[model samples]
Target: MLDAMIDDDHTAVRASTQDGTYPRPQLLRSAWTDLCGTWSFAYDDADEGIASGWSSAGVSERDIVVPFPPESSASGVGDTGMHRVVWYSRDLTTADLAGAGHAAGRRLLLNFGAVDYRCDVWVDGQLAGSHEGGHTPFALDITGSAREGARIVVRAEDDPLDISQPRGKQDWREHPHAIWYHRTTGIWQPVWLESVPAVHITALRWTADPRAGIVTADIELSVRPTTGTEATISLSFDGRELAAVSAVATDRETTVVIPIAELRNGQSYEELLWSPENPRLLDAEVRVGDDVVYSYLGIRTAHVARGRFWLNDRPYYVRSVLNQGYWPESHLAAPSAEALRDEAELIRSLGFNATRVHQKFEDPRFLLAADQLGLLVWGEAPGTYTFTPTAIERTTREWLEVVRRDMSHPSIVTWVPLNESWGVQHIAADPRMQHFARSLVSLTKALDPTRPVVSNDGWEQVDTDVVAIHDYEWRPDVVRQRYATDADIRRLIDSVGPAGRALILSGDVSEAPVMLTEFGGISFDTSAADGAWGYSSATSPDDFAERFEGLMAAVHASEALAGFCYTQLADTLQETNGLVTDERTPKIPVDRIRAAIVGHHAN
Candidate 1:
């Protein structure tokens, strides 16, 4: 039989006003508990009904850890290829749910931080629920299904290369090389249980309009009891009470708008705003009868007008890095909260104001850290290289998941659905792809019009708020020919006229921001090939440094370029062209890169 691994000791929940608190619903802790660390795991080829009878098949010979999927080393089941389905079974006692103020009879909710592709939950051998999207969190209310000491079994099946789902950066073909890695299957994040009242707030979404000096809040309830109830939504900015509005909550959504001027001590104009440099957050409290939900919101506004991106109605340059959020040990999941925080801090230390989460949707801890640290985030859906209708639906579903799960984070400034036309073939001509991109953009705008949405990051620019491009002039000759002479660079900029391309680069050049979404990828190796120095690899450290300096010089000199993100933050497997190594260790010391970008090294 598979050896059962014990769960981690629950950390004491402490409330802090400064940092260390997740920017989620206040009742999140008491309502949900993290089920991270070991559980009995097994794999089988039998039908789904046989999940409960793992012992009968003699499949208990080896154990796989829970939360961390079998493919990840962190899960203690390293590199299980895509040939088999993985099963995770664990026994949960009532004692496991005991803690400060937690009582019995509350609904026992099993929350999966994330399970790839598809997953099903079985309680006491009864199917409880199932989820489709792999990158978003899902929960099963295993209340009555659990006996006194019932065994809860979770079965997850992921066909990483199935070409029917949204598999971002995952190449399932044998040994993945170049821009792809091993497929992450089953539970790859924390799996835990939480107890909540039958009638409780399901989720909370906050949208801030810094220009209007108002914040609109939508509080959703899980269960709708007969007869509507009057709920109070309170807003506080920097400890000062903002507004307390009463709204009726039925079986549907409840919204309350609070003006910034009414909640602040002074006029709305006097209130502080949230930005990349200084992210100021306001505390919030929601109450339905005695049940209270707590959360925070940052006062910031993001928009694209003319041809520029604005933060709080001012032109702001979004210098950023492409963060893939992959680790050697954890794969998709970060090893710990500190690991997430370290990445944010490292990115900030590099003098960049933002980070574009390249392909994958990161864990909530990463988003929490970004919120607290005041970093701007461009969240993107995981892309599939190939195109299909099933893939399109999967992408749309995952995109919805991203917006719903990450809507409240103030750090998230933009939503990118399609990147580099990975799955979008013939974007302009293909009605389906165009419709999908336009729908996603509209959905993003309707959901949170406070921020801009990029329908497609590069190539065929659609009706997005911004015209973004990813130009990797990897070859030195291309770089020299484009920018070596001032006249050539000027001509290039002029060709992209003021209203370049219709917001096709044709938007107001002065107002609408033109972003070189991806550029400056110079790779360096101690023992490098002779010709690899130019386009793909740098011969020596000096060559890499020189190329980086030159790229930044041209970027700083260009007035048309509102912002640019260095090709990547770190190298991934064979993609050695990154500012930092795969392990997140800086390849070209942080100070040196910062000096070239932000210090005296100029155009």
Candidate 2:
């Protein structure tokens, strides 16, 4: 595509805000306004816009499509240059959300899905709040700031020199390199306004156990309610209530465990088991006084046992793909929610059970689609490549926040805090690095003990529930010889350090479930493209198929190996190794690739 055709790729982009879909499916509310669409924007090149009183200024001549960042053409401001700071302003009114009606008894709050780096928000000329971290959700109570007509201004700062921010695959250089793409500044996700009762449910957590016939829910309120405020919880399937209970809101948090199995009257129901074949979710509703929220949870279990991934106490093989979560027009921002749903469908159609969201913290809407569509995910943290105390502090804080934000999603099965030693490269030799890796594992387990935590995904093997590796050895014989047996896996890991590669040595690889986390990046450039490369280049389409099939078969035949993750699902800037092109067209029919990988499905 030519530079003149940038808008050609942006056609039919998903307007997430206007789509009326619940941004957070786990917690749904009926009253909200989509603060998306056109907004006034300007660049703060010297970081002097605030000093120049830009926040109080009227809309500028420049208009940027909101939600999409400046780096994306979809935003109408495709400036990929070094942007350290930027400003956005928009207008809203109380009447936009029923000013004196339902909102009169409620508090108006401003919510941001995500903002890259650091951002300060202003509402009606008053400071609302500020948030750090580019990959988590944050909100500000703007009830006091809302008026008949209100002005919202946002000041976002992204320093390429700041090594503390966890920016995944966002190149800090003047231009993109190798696998890195352009950087995103300001809001890369949907911004909206929500109205809630004065005392409402602030958060909800669900943990479902199929074998135990139990599902536990933890509810956090905005405040400790007085005597009259009580929370009523109900569970149902297909709108038929199975259980209902009420608890007084004396404290800010409440825990409720419902016995889902009791509905069967001591009978085993095979359909209750959730899996990729049959993804079932139970409907739940929470009501606190005038506040009502709806959510859902899939009844299932995920664990690692006997050196294999066990789902519902059965061995589950993960045929995953590395989804970088980029777009031709939007870059880091998704074009639409339906587009994300379509992408998930494409991945599932290729017979992949899981996706490793490599480096980037993928949009939550995609995870919501995964939960509804039955695709597993390995949630990873994006971090600075260089190691420092600042990087350590930033990664720890943001990673914990990410876990807190995403732990409710039933699709995510693993928590990968670091990938391929980007931030903590010296973890193999340095004692402090080793301790941090262990601490990350502990922190992940302490918060979300349900999911398996891989200390470092690709090469390093230090205190991890899953021992995964990134081997691009295209030769089938070498892959078979290297990981054919438990003994061979250990030898290959021990040989990694002496061979001048980075592999931290601590726990034995033989004790944990082994997976070829990354492999088979068969580059097939139809355009005979310049700078398009992968682990190996295929001379022809036939060659690509044979090479891909050979590599996949060798790994699948390895009885000692639990699973494998393909290099990628779709190609990104200059990387022609995906199963599909950057335009999202298939390089080869997915049926052929699925047959090559898994041979047959349940059908």
Candidate 3:
């Protein structure tokens, strides 16, 4: 139903990246085949698959849908128990490869949007590749082994009780409890195959400096180019050519800076600048050898200026909601690409310009939706529950990959490396934890200096650009009085915060941009489940509206705050504190909820 609300251009982009279509929006190629359907699945709980030669002679215990975890109902294999090792096998016909444009001189690449924890890919009984990290994309070249009737076998190992791994809100318990939801094990995203030339483009990155009229294009190739190999990059907007540049590529990677004359005009450049008000995207066509990539970029910048969040060099208010990005049916994997686009539109309809993708590196399709719909995003990494060397190493390694994979998206305005000190719980006095947090912030900044980085969000902050606090004071008067002035906010910052921990464990955040990142989690579910709850509760719809309006009014009128993010966008499992239900139906009317968010009156 939300699809009808999207405009013609947005609808076009949404339709192109639908489920079983192109999963990667940042770097898209036409020659691709969706590998999402029924796959033979088996659980290797006894961990005897490797010794039993399951990869060579695949096991078929049951059939499960590709891209949905076995723990989810959508997968048709709703096994929620602890099955550390799971195997998936699918046969690819020669027709599939040929349809994907595979040829003699081309490379046939198997890609996974994401597979939880760790996985090993076997093509026709030969190990093709292996990847760790549940939240990032990976590809394997199966050109040599993949043939007619080739059997592709995948084994995924995800320890359900591994608190050291960054699992986000996935409950380590056998059953869902509290705010944590059911586990998402094994392949929880799209799987596809792509064919390209041997020396094809592997990755594409875009960095836009709207004020300088320059856009930097970094292109990575499958292999280093020959002596005279060249790459051409063309940029266009609204059916008009803006800039084009070609450069010789002798190495695997090549960087080109193209200046757009239209973006240089001080008076009319605003038309081209990307913002929540104008989500104009510049089209890009990149060519390297016989390979081509179709991509796009938004000319925008995000920074903190004078203790205020600035977008495109102008101060902007961030009305955001904490979106955990969960579904009752599919868990982490979205029901469809159309559902992801509809999500952004729904958030925008409620009058929020941004969403804090809480505790998870969301699917790229959601980020694509945010980009297309002018909805800002705060990209965050899923946190580990325990602090250990493995935890630190794993968190750091995956966080870097997350940043690199998503840095080019203009919708992401901030990067939160740590949240609520999940892994580094004793960061207040532990030097190692503090150092790790600081290092994550520094590393994020080193990688992407364009966006503000939150070293640790919520409380126990060390060094952060945004002083984000999570205060769920249900009393509207207390909320209004606490953040009513600069002095009050500073006092709260210096002392214990709403989360009962020191807001600032180390720095002088006197000048940092302040925001109430989390609050107003009022539970009001008419058909509440057994464990459904919230930080606060409202009895009826009228009571819910009153409490929501009161808290929002105080937050919106606060002069000391740069922005605020409500507890959630939609209900996630037992967490019934969402503006909308898990089905995405607003508990209150859409217009009234929008009025509460933007300080406007409902008709």
Candidate 4:
């Protein structure tokens, strides 16, 4: 474990020997320890670990990486089978606890970035806490349970074949097929520990309004502070101080509003607004007593108006790529913090201003990179296959958690709750499914009204601000004919979509902003995969380059389209239709692909 600090600029100022990236990028503290690396692991095939008191003892039979699931090769236990019950244990000494920082008045908290399905945490043979939902993060306070020779243990249970669960791309089949891959059963993200004051901020959210020239922060504390306890929030840009505001806390929650005088006093607000071209971020420092948390926010606003996607009150074209966020060795977990940063840079290098994080809630570190690199994100969740009471309960619970966990990121401009009608397959005809989709949109908007909410991203749209469609038609002429004019786009919206389903379930959205959200999945690589397939296939690199350029030309020439998202950024398992290989090697020249994507290629 290594300790790090957040500099005055709200960037991580790490020790020279620090190897891991900070887990929580938005909220930063000076004293924290990375609890990643090796941990004693075991498989409870017979479900006997809990009954046998495994949580109170060590499972030293096998060693597994802390954040990577046992299913991934990076975990050092490349077993992709159905291990519903998995146990992890690690030992920590008093000296190890002291490594976090001064410990006299501070309480120790254990945090997990994410764990699949459900898990329970135990510290020093006592149940510290438990959490559900695989893709969202949670923390547990172990102040009273920590001592010398502290033993930390975890128990995770996930049913791989449960179609009712939001499994995402994790295939339930014996082998990878179609678009599904292997399962990620247990702890597949970073775990860490930090020392915090008895009364500390538990959550922080920043909202930026460039038009209003103000930024608001909502702070949640561990407990209500005493009288006269004040919270100070300071904002700065490029190391120059902007505004500092203070508030007296009367409850566990408080709000601070800092109005930027420069934006209102004739200063060029364009220089401060966040966009793909200029990802201007305002650094902030929040202090309450001895608790200080550093954070940052991008001043921007995104919405849909007059049949166009608008950023900072101006129409902005969304050139996006569908990102699965999977790696060959690490599965859902990124190989390293540097890898997450590189992934964002890779997407930007392909001339995409945005990325639709397909079917998974990505790492916060990746979102941080997007914020810094000026990439817009469409936050989506894994959809369950079946539509049942259990499925609805699980999906709703988890989707809300995902939105709440990620809505603060300025890079994220949209919230996609359902995609291609996975859980609500009969949404077009079933009123219940339609209602479910609509309710998700309403709930998401209730939590966050700053961004648009796509009720169903691909098709079968129940209620969506963006008219998103998925068309794999490879012919450039036909693609041109489909969206050549506003009338053609309206007719297509009222008709059956490319997936052979109604584009809209009940709404009259002929005037909403239209986007080709999924298209051009042209498979060009077959060297690594035996039965690799895509929506369309090309024989060679030149063929691929031509096909890609043609499809993109039609999309870029559309008079009715507000944006487009190519499917996808890279290949995954049997789905080899990617601009780049699974390892992120561009099949065609990077410049050639970028030219086509940006509409600068010489057709």
TM-score of each: 0.88, 0.93, 0.96, 0.96
Model 1 misplacement above 4 A: 1-27, 46-52, 55-59, 100-105, 146-148, 262-271, 475-511, 526-535, 599-603
Please write out the lDDT profile of model 4 over residues 185-246, one tens digit for every residue: 88999998888999899899988877788899999999999998899998887666789999
Give per-residue lDDT, candidate 4, residue 230. 91
Candidate 1 worst ten-residue window by lDDT: 1-10
Name the top lDDT candidate. 3
Screening candidate 2 with a backbone cut-off below 3 angstroms (N, C-alpha, C), the clashing residue pairs are 14-335, 14-336
Q: What is the C-alpha lDDT profile of model 1 across 194-242, one tens digit per residue?
A: 6666776777788876556678888777777447677787776545566
Candidate 4 local Cα displacement, residue 476, angstroms = 1.6
lDDT of 3: 0.88
Please provide, for model 2 over 1-603, each residue's C-alpha lDDT reduced to its tens digit, 9 standing for 90 to 100: 012211234421111112225466577665667777899998888888877887766348599997899999999989899889889998786565673233565788788889988899988788889999888888788888667667889999999767657887888787777778789898998887788888888788888776667778888888888887878878866445667888776788888777775535445655666677777667777888888876777777888988899887788888889999988899988888888888889898888888998887887788878887899999999978778888888899999987887887888999999888778777777888888888999999998899898888887657888888888888988887777887777676667732356554676545578888989888998766568878898888788898998888788767788888999888888778999887788888778888876743222
Q: Residue by residue across 6-68, what tens digits does model 3's lDDT show? A: 235652222222232468887887667889989999999899999999988887999999899
- Greater-lDDT candidate between 2 and 4: 4
Clashes of each: 20, 2, 0, 0
lDDT of 2: 0.80
lDDT of 1: 0.69
RMSD to the hidden true structure, all candidates: 5.6, 5.9, 3.2, 2.6
